[model samples]
Target: MRRPAAFLNLIFSRRSIRRFRPGKIDAEVLKIILEAAQSAPYYYQAFCFILLEKPEIKREINESCGGDFIEKAGASIVVCLDLNRISGLLDRLGIVHVLKADTYPVESVLGVFESGLAVMNLIMAAEVMGYGTLILDCALYECERISEILKLPHGVIPLVIVCIGEKDENPPPRPRWPLESLFHVDGYRMLSDEESERFLENMDKAYSVEGYLKKYAGWAGSYREYLANRALLTREVRRAYESISAFLRRSGFRP
Candidate 1:
């Protein structure tokens, strides 16, 4: 096998950093990161970034989104699925039929897909530039409140918040499922109950060694318990889902 490129190492070494040293990112460096995002391959170009640098704005977002680390980062960037720009262009070109009610679902999916590609590029660029970064999806939990705080207009929905800054702590990489379970050959491979249990055991042992349960969920004894405690069928999770759905509908991404 050919050796991996040096840049690929950056992807392997990247970790989600929560603690950051106090310092603002240089304007030139931030501009380069944004340029990298623009370089991502896209089918519809339906994405935009809202950069939050002010302490007050960051504090507001942190409160609304429930990511306490957001306020401490050098900058927090909201990566949004923005179909508004496309809708405007279509309007100018007299192509209104493309964005009719039936197409909203398809547009929403495509917008999120394209935005994810851009987000990966933005993150890798920042990592290669020696900045610690954290990706927070908590923004989705309170999307309506966040939209109000960010003053997002129609046809634009915040997907994730990327926080970048200097690293204050160095931690080992988090545990992940085995590659055999994740990667399949030509066709999908179904795992047996035994295989599933083995994978879970391995993950639980690894997380226990790292003290992940104590740090994140002290009440949970194992990683499996931690996951069970955060089950999605609960009332709070349902409310978050409802809020996200309402935001998507109001932003014209849902029918």
Candidate 2:
């Protein structure tokens, strides 16, 4: 399929940028980008964004977020949803159906997907305007604290935080798995032991444990420990999941 010129430009040039030049994205441009984000499709619910603009606030957020790069970001956006607005929007937009009297699927599997579509639009808009952007799932800092700072009411779960700015470096394209390895024609087909070796052959060695250890220590090791130690994944994970549940319940999204 032939993509329109601007669409192709968005797809090719959109890269997650951590490093950013110290500057500001203009107000008009930021508004346009937000409009683009809101225009994204909803599979089951509607989500809104909270745009973080003030430098002092961004600095505070940077401390909580654990990344120095965030302090220089031109802007940050927190994607969230008002449960009823989402529920109503989903029904109105045909994103959700009244499957039964007291049951709704929007609260479960579909919310993330809705957010994904909206964020893509956000990225596309930022990229087209010559701004580099990074989707910060881990750099959002404290969700509840941010809610308090932003003055967001109960029920808004900030799923993804995006930081945007002028880019500094041109990182080389990382290798991708071969077409055959990634694209399966149909069905779940199990690979033979020999076939698995062949699959790994075409894959870049940088993805391997030894290769990763050369650049950064303890990545694969930590993962290995995660496999061995149940505590590694549980300590930080349960609270977040519980928080999501709490937000959902408070916002009228069950589960």
TM-score of each: 0.93, 0.71
- Give the lowest summed-lDDT range of ten residues in model 2: 209-218
Candidate 2 per-residue C-alpha lDDT over 23-106 given as tens digits, one digit per residue, 9 for 90 to 100: 888999999998898788765455777777687777776766776666778888777754546545556766545422244544
lDDT of each: 0.82, 0.65
In angstroms, how far off is 170's CA in candidate 1?
A: 1.8
* Deviation in Å, model 2, residue 117 alpha carbon: 0.9
lDDT (tens digit, per residue) of candidate 1 on 109-196 = 8778889899889889898899999889866666777888888899888889999999898777788878888899899999889888
TM-score of 1: 0.93
- List residue ranges in candidate 2 displaced over 4 A: 1-6, 43-45, 87-103, 139-141, 175-182, 190-255
List clashing residue pairs in candidate 1.
Answer: none
Candidate that would win on TM-score: 1
